[model samples]
Structures are given as C-alpha cells and as structure tokens.
Target: MKKSIIVSTLILSSSLTFAFDLSAIAKNVVENVTKEQTTTQETSTSNLSDTTVSNGLKEALKTGVNYAVTQLGSNNGYLNNTAVKIPLPDNLAKAETLIRSIGGDKMADNLINSMNTAASKAAPKTAEVFVEAIDKMTLTDAQAILSGGNDAATNYFKANTSDSLKKLITPIIQETMKENQVASYYDTANNLYKSNVKGLVDNSGVMGLAKNFGVDSFIPGSSDESLDEYITTKAIDGLFTMIGQKEAAIRANPLEQTSSILKEVFGK
Candidate 1:
C-alpha cells in the first residue's frame, strides 16, 4: 500500500508540472506574437510617398486639433474635464483652502467656477492659431514625427508655437475673464476672507515673518501670477495636452485615423 501511494504522488507532481509548463509556454508564445506584430507595424510605414505622408500628418493634426478645440470651447468644457480644468493660482489656492475652512464655500466656489468659465471661453481662439501652424508644417517635420515617438508632433508644436499661442491666448483670456466676471468673483471672495480672522493673517507681522523665513513661497498671496497670465498659461497647456493625447491615440490604433490619407499612410 505504501509503494502504491508513492507512485501516485509522483504521477500527480509530474502532471501538475506539465500543466504549469504549458501555461508558461502559452505566455511566451503570446509575447512573441505581440512583438512580431509591433515590428511589422513599424516597418509598414517605411514605403509611403513624401506627399502621402505629409498630407496624412496634416489630416491627423487637423482632426485632433479641431476635436480638442471644440471640446474645450464648449460651455463648461474646462469646468467638466478635471484632467484639464483650470484651478486657482498656487498662492490663491492656499487662500481658497483657508476660505473653505472658515465657511466661505460659496465665494470660493464662485471664483473657481469663473476661472474655468473664462478658460472655456478663451479656448476657441486657439483653433485659428493651430490651423496656421498645421498648414506651415514642413515635410521634413512630418517624416521625423512619423519615425519618432508618439508625442513628437506635440513636442514640435510646443517648441515652435508656444510663444505665439501665449501671445494670442493672453488677450482672449483677459477678455473672457471680464465677460465671465472672474475678477468680480475674486473681489467678492477676497472681501469675505477679509471679514474672517484668516484675512488678518495677511496683514499681520506673521506674513512678514513667513516671508523672511522662506515660508512665503508656501504662503497665500505670495505668488506674482496675475489672474490673466495664469489663465492664459493654463489654457494653452490644456489645449496642447489634449492634442498630445489625440496624437498618441491615432498613432497607437490605426482605427483612430479617420481619413483615407491617414489610413493609407499609417497602414491597416
């Protein structure tokens, strides 16, 4: 009986090992297949004509850029997308925290809402600027971006167009802020905070001490970012961030390419 039991145990162990080996072998096969598919996809783009590639890139950019602008320019666009929502400037954010702690939620909320509203209003102006940039994209730029990483085009835009975008966006943000009553909201919030004890902290020697001790960097009201500059910077950044995502998506999935040119250049 003992000898029989030993033989059964050996058989069971071998069976379990075989099953495990099969599972490992299957995983390796899947990994190899995935690698081969990726390689093929990369090599597939090598034969495209110069014009086809350039037009494909331009079409992709137009689609991605328009989508981003439309999404962000709509009502409550920035307000809804937490990923790209504009927030209080760093220093003012500290003030917001204090305002909330002292039952000033209404005013604090208004300021936050108005800031995002201003960003949404200012978003559409970017479409024109982006279209101009895309039109000016060089064939060489297209080829490099196709062969380079996913965010290469976005990086190109950043390097080439950021300054122009900021210039265009700043005035629009200023106008939007006026239309949205962002400053009015801020003024009302500031009044509420001033009525609270936390407001006194800003005037007292405490702020002076913090400034001298290198704590001012962490203190509210210490940052020099005017509301206009803050909103403009964040707005442009948000647009580009969304555009980069769209570019990456199109690059990863050929199905994301919506045009005939894109499909032809990127391949099936």
Candidate 2:
C-alpha cells in the first residue's frame, strides 16, 4: 500500500508541472501574435498616409498648371494679357520696316504670326511637364508652394522644367520660323543691316561689315545673346505667369460653381 501511494503522488506532481508549462507557452504565443498584428497595422497606416500626401501635392500642381496654360493658350493670351505680354524689341523694328518696305511685308507678317502661334501652342505643354514635377514634391513642398507668391510656383515650375521646355520650344520655334518663310525675312534683315553699317562706316570711316553679319565680334560689353534667348524664354515665362495669376485667384476667392472633385479637394 505505501509503495502504491508514493507512485500515485509522483504521477500527480508530473502532470501538474506539464500543465503549467503548456499554459505558460500558450500565453507567450498569444502575446507575440498581438504584437505582430499591432506592428503591421501601424506600418500600413503610415504608408497609406504618405501616399495620400504625395498624391495631394500632384493634384495641386496639376490644377495650377492647367489653369495657367488655359489662360495663355486662349486668344490674346500673351499680347493682350498684361501680366506676361511680350513687347516688341526695339532693335527689330527698323529691321521689320526695312523688310516691309522692300516687298517682304507678307513674309514679315507671316513671321509675326508664326511667333505668336508657336507661343500659344507651346504654352499649354508647360503644364504637362510641371505636373510631372509636382509628383516629386513632398508634403512640405506642397505646403510651401501653396503659401508662396504668385510667381513662386511659376518659378519653381521653371526651375524644374527649363531644360525640357527649351528642348521642346527650340524645335517648335525653328519649325515655325521655317514654315513661315523666316529665311526670306532674314535675308531682308541682312540687307538692311549691311546698308545701315555701310552708311555708318561711310560717315565714321570705321569698318563694321563683319559685325553686321555676326561674323566679327560686337563692341565690348554689348551682347545680344540674352535678347535672342528671351524670345522663347519670355514665352515660357509668360505661360507660367498666367498660371500663377489664376492659381492665386483660385486660392484667394475660389470658384463659385466648381466641380464636385474640385470642391472636395480645394473646398477645404
């Protein structure tokens, strides 16, 4: 009897110890599972928030760019628009008159039309490139652009899109100039330049024929590269200038009858 009781006690003690170990293991497993779930939830939330902020920035930029391009592409977008209208360059007036007087009136008019058309056509595309840049913006950048001046956003667009804009506008300008028979106008211009230089040389006894043809250097500190560069650059600048104007207006007073999405996005 004593031996059997001792054997029973040992069996009970072993069972209790085994049960305690299983309970401890189950508690640890439950705790680990809960921690993993919490971490996954936090990570998903963070990623979603980042995506929202990024997309928001892109939308704002797209809106601004579209508004600007639309204004510029419209009739008299550059010529009538006060914010970015390109004025006639003084040096080209005499050249234009000489060409017109020399029976190149049609060619000169075509050249003007070509320049204007190119400006209008190329103005709208700037927004497309700017929208791409906006995608790269962070939340902080979006906030900064929104709060910045009318030209601040435009300046930013220029900063990002200048190289691409040049690549695009240069070809378009070249094409327009050719299609409008710019070569004919240039010939007239060259003749006028030569005549003027010849008269000046006759009076002053100084040879400037090379300078007239751009074969020799001009007077010291008299560079015209900036003037030529402005032809296209001004058009691009005007495009963004109009956009910045519209953007500012939208931000300040907003539209009365905006689209549902616009209301949803900008109404806030």
Candidate 3:
C-alpha cells in the first residue's frame, strides 16, 4: 500500500512539472513575439522620422515639377490644352468681334495664336523657378505639407514662389511675345479699330457713346499693360494647376512615389 502511495505521488509530481514546463514555453514564445513586434515597429518609425519625411516631401515635389514641366513644355502643350488655352483678354474680346466684323478675323486669330505660343514658350522656364522654390522648402514646411490637405504643397509653392516666378517668367514671356509678333499684331488690330470705329463713336453725338458701343473701351490707350503681362500671368497659373494635380496624385497613390525614401515615408 505504501509503494502504491509513493508511485501515485511521483506520477502527480511529474504531471505538475510537465504542466509548468508547458506554461513557461508558452510565456517565452509570447514574450519573444512581442519583442520582435516592438523592434519592427520602432525600426519603421525611425525610418520615417522628420528628416526622412522632409526629404520624401521634397522628392515628391521635385517629381511633380518635372512631370508638370515635361507635360507642359511639349509641342501644343498650352495651345492644345483647352483648360490652359490662352484666350483673348476680356477687354480685347469686344475688339476681336469688331475686328472680325470688319473683315479682320485673320488678325484677331493671329493675336490669339501668338499669345498661346508665348505662353508655351515661357512655360519651360517655370521649372527653374520651381526648383528654386523646392530648394527653399524648410523641414517645418514639409511636415505641414504632408499633414495638410492634398493641395498643401501646391499652395506652399504658390505663396512662396509667386513673386520670384513673376520676376523670372516675365522677361521670358516678354521675349517670347516679341519673337511671336504678339505686340505687332496687337498694334495692328488697335490701329484698325481706331481708324474704322474710333471716329464713328466720337462723332455719334451721344455722351459716353464709346462705352455704349464697346469700341474704344476695348482698345487700351498708351501706358496700359501689354498682352505679354496677361500671357505671363496665365502661364504661371497653368503651371501651378498642373503641379497641383501632380501633388494630389502623389498624395492619393503611394505607388507614385519615385524614390525609396518616398516609398518608406509616404507608404505609412
């Protein structure tokens, strides 16, 4: 009976030891898994810190600028694109109608074509301005852009680079306008209106008759801004529009990230 009791006690002790061993093994496995998970998380977080995030943002901007410039600098970029097509200024539309009425439709068409051509020519110069703006992007600026809405980067570029872009692009636009004969066309159209319609409105015997007929109102007198200014402004606006689209695209699709840093930082 005593041997029977001893055997039973030994069996109980062995079962208890086996259960303890199993419990320890399970605890070790859980602890190991948790440590490994924590390590992975910390590594991922370290890779996407402020500096990396800032670099990723800059890379995204650079990629966007390059894409926008390539698309806009090609043949018929501005001329073919209805969205960014340079139309006659509102003040000049009336003049165009009157000129067309007087068998000067070709002249009006020429003016419109020349304006778009100038915008296309000057569009290529915007990349240099964009690069300058990107170079000026601060870490804080990048963080803000990343956290902000889709157009945040685009708005930043506009606010920061508008004045500099104007200075850089205006001369190119002016030169393009001259090369494309925009000024000459404007001058010819202005003279034709003055000769044919100016006298009729002046002698119509009605006060403010010029305004009523929309004749002299369309022709800008001396000291007024030239067509080049309008074209430059519109071209700049179009460039930003394209850049904004690119920015939104990158924000939406992680696959659009071109660089490793971009993938890591934005993939999160």
RMSD of each: 7.0, 17.7, 11.0
Q: Write the per-residue lDDT of candidate 2 for residues 1-268, one digit (tens) a residue.
A: 9999999999999999999999999999999999998887666545544445445445655766787788777876776676776643444544566556679787766655556666776776666677777777767766667557766677778778888887777766565555656644554555555556546654673445545666333322222433335457878878677667666665565572144443433444
The lDDT leader among the candidates is 1
Q: What's the TM-score of every candidate structure?
A: 0.72, 0.57, 0.68
Order of models, best lDDT first: 1, 3, 2
Model 3 segments more than 4 A misplaced: 1-47, 95-98, 101-103, 180-182, 185-224
Inter-residue clash pairs, candidate 1 = none
Highest TM-score: which candidate?
1
Candidate 2: RMSD over Cα atoms? 17.7
* Clash pairs (backbone) in predicted model 3: none
lDDT of 1 at 236: 82
Deviation of model 3 at 222, angstroms: 9.5
**Candidate achieving higher TM-score, 1 or 3:** 1
Error of 2 at 181 (Å): 3.4
